[model samples]
Target: MTKKVRSVRPDTSFKETALALIQNRLSGVPVVDRQGRLVGIVSESDLLPREALDDDLLASAQAFFEGTFDWDSLFKNRKAVALTAGELMTTPVQTATPHTLLRQVAKRLSESGLRVLPVVDHGKVVGMVTRHDVLKVYCASDADTLCNVKDALEHRGYVPPRHCIDASVHEGIVTLGGTTIDPEGLRRALALVRAMDGVVAIRNLVRVDSSAG
Candidate 1:
């Protein structure tokens, strides 16, 4: 299952938005319109402080501060609080579909240097995808783990008992059945399943081979 989404409106003030992000411990916020359409996103990178001053201004300010400039008066003359979301927001945002596989999404996030991706549906924004969400959901989501296990076993000289041993995956559970050489072989097969990634459980019914010629 995926996570629920939280978003903010485009008209939200940068001051308020920054405060919200800080309070939630979030790196950024998705900016949406009144119809819930994704307009842009604002991140900490967007809120970077501007250059302290131009060359001439910096020299004068440095000389004054070193000499007799009052800290309170000079600070009051500076303007840093005027930044806004509209001025700092990143536009033409990248997005992800909800049905997108988590592995692919994680790769996109890493390659794009983006911490979050807005989840869209039919060109409309529906939710958001964050790095944390990608890690939690994709790491836990079921993949072709059973196939991996079977392939590993085949590579490790663990030959299945002819047509006796079979393997399959369903809903993160690895199902192993059919006869093997002995109880130890069956245990080895189960261990293969256990070692696989994304395998939530193993259902083993492989009987110990006791066939008599």
Candidate 2:
């Protein structure tokens, strides 16, 4: 489980809390109380009903040129609706105890369509679980095996575009990163990496240069 957790207070404004979720690109935020106990879960679905406009929402998203977001105007015009985390959150939240089995947690989250799960211990929020963390656990195989795989790839025609390309193997999972390329290249590279022995996954930070520069 990852140490990083995103949380909000029950009294937090709906707009403010939703903005925080967007800022983090998180599917949901844990609603905590004064003592940091998990009370509810707030997700994007909770914000969608308000017809709120995000800070980066463009009139025409495809067009590169757009006016700056006037937050003050948005607020004054009541474009920003007032909501509290408590009013918008989902109660009886599905949760996992700290000692809950990983497979169980994965299954529950998968079936429920929840992107993140709050790790609770003694009825208090302690950590969080996301799909990425679950995948990372299975993808990192072992250090030496990952290094050998990287070496084999380098020997083969696959190139690591940046100094950041790294490999890790733990429990037969492989993670690769530190490369930059277009989406097609990334897909090809990751496919090749997955072809290696004991490579169960690849964590890619490969950036695509979309500019015509």
Clashes of 2: 11
**Mind sharing the TM-score for model 2?**
0.51
Per-model C-alpha lDDT, please? 0.66, 0.69
TM-score of each: 0.51, 0.51
Candidate 2: where are CA atoms >4 Å away?
23-25, 52-82, 142-213
The TM-score obtained by model 1 is: 0.51
Candidate 2, 1-213: lDDT as tens digits: 645666789889877888867765668888999998899998877777457455434432423355555656544434234478887788889998887866678787899888888889998878778877666654543775667777876765455543334566557766665545456656767777765544555666555655622
Q: Backbone clashes in each candidate structure, one number apiece?
A: 0, 11
- Residue pairs with colliding backbones in model 1 are none
Distance from true location, Cα of 211 in model 2, Å:
71
